[model samples]
Target chain A: MDYDYIDRLLERYWKCETSLKEESELRTFFSKSDMPKRFLPYKDLFVYQQIQKTVGLGSDFDVRVLSKIEPPVVKAKRLTMFVRIKPFLRAAAAVALIVLCGNITERSYFADDKLDYNYKDYKDTFHDPEVAYKKVSSALMMLSEEIKKSKSQHFPDSLYQNDLDSVCTK
Target chain B: MHEFSFQDDILPLKDKLFRLALRITMDRAEAEDVVEEAMVRVWEKRESYSNYDSVEAFCLVVTKNLALDMSQKKDAQNLSLDESMAESEMDESDPYHQLANNEKLKLIHRLINELPERQRLVMQLRDIEGESYKKIALVMNITEAQVKIDIFRARQKVKQRFLEIDGYGL
Candidate 1:
């Protein structure tokens, strides 16, 4: 078998001068048996390329990929299920939220009952106006005296401590 | 416009995408991830595929970009450099013929992997995948002339380096 044409084409192929069709012819020629020894160096490379084309994804790869990207027909069924219940689910959630808010408002209003009881006690005390006035005046005077006494005892110490703190911080 | 069927069209591309991804990243797992990602992307962008000239070319471009992006993001060294050497051990039964063939195959694989990025892709698309120059140009987003030049340079480099290795017994 004369490989002169193939050798010429192979040269052209190495130089990237061959067209696609010519390269295909070379590939076909190299793939067959009885390749001459002179071309042995280039034989394995082309054969390896032919084998490399067989390098592929596994048999299960399609199932794996399709499962991920394109949802199965069952997904459409699941979507239908979701579509049926979505409005009801929304309504239920809204109702639950409203109920929760109502309960919170009621609890807040009831929380002030202790303050109401304290107000009742004050109302009872102020029923006797003149006595209440004397009592309030006495209380006010006692608080004023207490404040004045504390100020005299601690104001100097606090002022000195503040100055120390400021100096230390700086 | 042709319809994009997962079973008929997209799923069949898994092998080609896997090979391209594997060629670039040189890690089987990473290549698998890249192909899966590419598959999902093609499915997601199925609507816009009508605008493209070729779906196969579009998918190849996507896979190449994704593989390159993955390598870039992880700062992955070209794992192909070391790994292809380890993978070329064929069956030991046919020692004389198989051993020489396997060594040459491994050397070829490593040499191809060592090619520059553009040339490697061009050679892969042209030689391994049996893609036309026009399709390769579309996938690589280069002119057909550039594709020709890249393939030429890549093939010559492989041939020269291969002969040198044989001569030096490396």
Candidate 2:
């Protein structure tokens, strides 16, 4: 049990003079159970460093990290007949929607055409020409009265003409 | 150009990246999150991985930056190590020895954690993960000489504090 080499390597290790391999040797030497009493104080440090090497994430760590880094490998889900036809199903749905919409629109348009045809077959509510002429005259007279009231409430045409003349004179 | 497969190449680095993240954040959950984000970030740039000299080094850099950022955001730099998480697989027949060893392991963890960020990271990358100086320097964005300096200072501080604690116990 000569520990001269280990002691020297330890000394060099403290001085940062040992190579990585030499430092590794010191670690291996300290890892043994039968360490010299003089080296006991420092043994824990080396052994702890060795143990720290094992301070890794759990077995699930790889799974967790790979899930993040590997991009969820989108395992080509064994495309069942249903899955295989998914795109076609989507297209078929879109086409069915379009056809349904088209049918509804066409039916609505036909209903509108029927309404238009009914309008073309319209009959006058007033049957007699004399009664129709009297109603038209009264409606025209009321419209003219309303128009005259609105026009009077606003600027009169004579006033507007005076303002325009003033501006022209100016 | 070596074809870098995510499963074959990058996925395998998870444990190493986890350990690095765990070292920085001192929170298993936060560390896991950082590692996940780093892996996803690297995977996103998988197309440009060939442009880099070493994808592994690039991944380490990404993990380090992400861990540092998260730890800073949470202000978890001074958080205590989760003793339960550090359970070693070593089967010690004697309960007394196991308790003593566990105590020593805790002290060692605290000592390492108390180190300055750069020194702690350098020591972790070098002594624990068995990374080369070149790789560590690349990951830390420092010179190889600076990596060596930090590691030396880190080792000295750990040893000094370990000795002080052991001395006080006696």
Measured over all alpha carbons after superposition, the RMSD of each candidate to the real structure, in angstroms, is: 15.8, 11.7
* lDDT values for all models: 0.81, 0.81
* Segments in model 1 whose C-alpha atoms lie over 4 Å from true places: A72-170, B76-101
Instruction: Pick out the ten consecutive residues of candidate 2 chain A with the lowest summed lDDT.
Output: A70-79
User: Residue B74, candidate 1: how far off, in angstroms?
Assistant: 2.1
- What digit string (tens of lDDT, one per residue) describes model 2 on residues B40-69? 899888777664568888899899999988
How would you encode candidate 1's per-residue C-alpha lDDT over A20-130 as one tens digit per residue?
Answer: 788778878888878788887777778878888877777777777878976656533446887889999999999999999999999898986654545545636367789
Per-residue lDDT of A75 in model 2: 61
> What is the two-chain DockQ of model 2?
0.43
lDDT of each residue in A1-170, candidate 2, tens digit only: 66998888888888999998998888888889997789988888888888877666666977877776655556655658998899999999999999999999999878756545556778778879998999999999999999998987699889988998999999
**Steric overlap count per candidate:** 0, 0
Off by over 4 Å in 2: A72-170, B50-52, B76-101
lDDT of 1 by residue, B1-170 (tens): 66778788788888899889978877677889999999899889988876458677778889999999987765565555345434433323422124235777868877888898899989999998888888888888899999999988998899899888976874
